[model samples]
Target: MFADVRRRPGNYGLGGTFREASAFVNGCDAGNSWGLLIGFREWLALKLGCEANLTWAGLILKLADVDASLHPSGSNLSATEDERAVEVLFAELDEFLSARKGASDVGRILEKYLRQNS
Candidate 1:
């Protein structure tokens, strides 16, 4: 689903931007279980090593290297941040949709985080 959205967001009536993509993803997650949400939130928290109180969307955006404060104003992602957020969100979803069905891609996100830190 996310892969398709990532590939052709225009087909989804989206501007091919992360803000819209994230909203659509979140809406789907809220409306449907999809079996993918199971443990995914916890996995995101563990991956971030942060409190689990945050929404999975927020965690994913953080993983994408987007600026924080996702809750304060519903993620004020810039053009670059939106692009990165969508990239990483779909990356994580790709793993979830795979046979492994886990957060093995977390290392990839952490690598980006590490590079940023350095």
Candidate 2:
């Protein structure tokens, strides 16, 4: 369980399959855990390049939009803008990953995007 893993810091590693690890981590229902998992998959997609499926990218975009929309102080216009941003992010990620770039490359792109937005 996630609690067990948290209690024993050295026990958990990236050794098991992503599904199993993700399920265990999300079982705790902690804030942003699912988003973190989505981030990890995006990282992998960047590494695998064209091998990464579009479905995953779509799901990530959906989650991002949902998160932004659910923000407590977000207005309708802000939500719309966030949704548009998520759409753009998905398009760029799809293009970059389709080019077979590595995680670091994708990370740099993400960093630039985040900085510009902030």
Candidate 3:
């Protein structure tokens, strides 16, 4: 996921990026291709707690201890916010991979890819 974001062309928006990535992964596993997306979504949803929208930006800001108003427009995160977002992304990702269990082969592969690339 991090690698996917990094390989992209321009600025990776927050909540939208995560939502899209999750959807893409889910689509890829439409027929339980890896039996991972559902679990991943569930885990992410759980991590997000009671967010009404459950967006990646919310999770990122929560994890980074940043204020939501910093990006009121939701798309134009400041340079500092962008840096903090990346930091929170890597930190949360590391935590997720370290604590993950019972992951499908595809999930393991994805995690491995992230570990290798990161």
Candidate 4:
């Protein structure tokens, strides 16, 4: 779902903006009561090599040099920054999901996260 969200946002029902994509993920997570996104943050923190307590959106924004004050919920990034942010987000999600294998995916991801963040 995320692999090509940046290049084809319409297909994912997104508004072709990083903020929209971020919102979509948030909705999905909340819709599942956060269970679905449980391991995502740990996986992302591992990928980023930090335990900054950032959501995936914040982490992506940090990588894009976006100010935390202008986070997705209230972001107003320029088109170029928005696009870069989307690109970074998709790249990170792709890497995180690429390790999918089965029910243990989350456990595997968490293990990696603990190793890196500890």
Q: Would you list the rank order by lDDT, best first?
A: 4, 1, 3, 2
Give me the displacement of residue 99 in model 2, in angstroms. Answer: 21
Give the per-residue lDDT digits (tens) of candidate 1, residues 70-114.
433235667787788788878876775563434555445445445
Residues 1-84, candidate 3, lDDT per residue (tens digit)?
Answer: 555553561445434343343344345457556543333433443555532344544556655555666554234666666666
- Pairwise TM-score winner, candidates 1 and 4: 4
The predicted structure with the larger lDDT, 2 or 4, is: 4
TM-score of 4: 0.77
Reference-based TM-score, model 3: 0.44
Q: Which stretches of candidate 2 lie over 4 Å from their true place?
A: 1-19, 28-30, 54-118
lDDT of each: 0.68, 0.42, 0.49, 0.75
Candidate maximizing TM-score: 4
Could you list the CA RMSD of all candidates, in the order they appear? 6.9, 13.6, 9.4, 2.5
lDDT of 1 at 24: 85
Winning model by lDDT = 4
Model 4 clash pairs are: none
Per-residue C-alpha lDDT of model 4 across residues 1-118, encoded as one tens digit per residue: 5656666889877787878888887887798777766677777677667894977788788777777576555278888888888888777777666775455998888887887767
Q: Please tell me which model should have the higher TM-score, number 3 or number 4.
A: 4
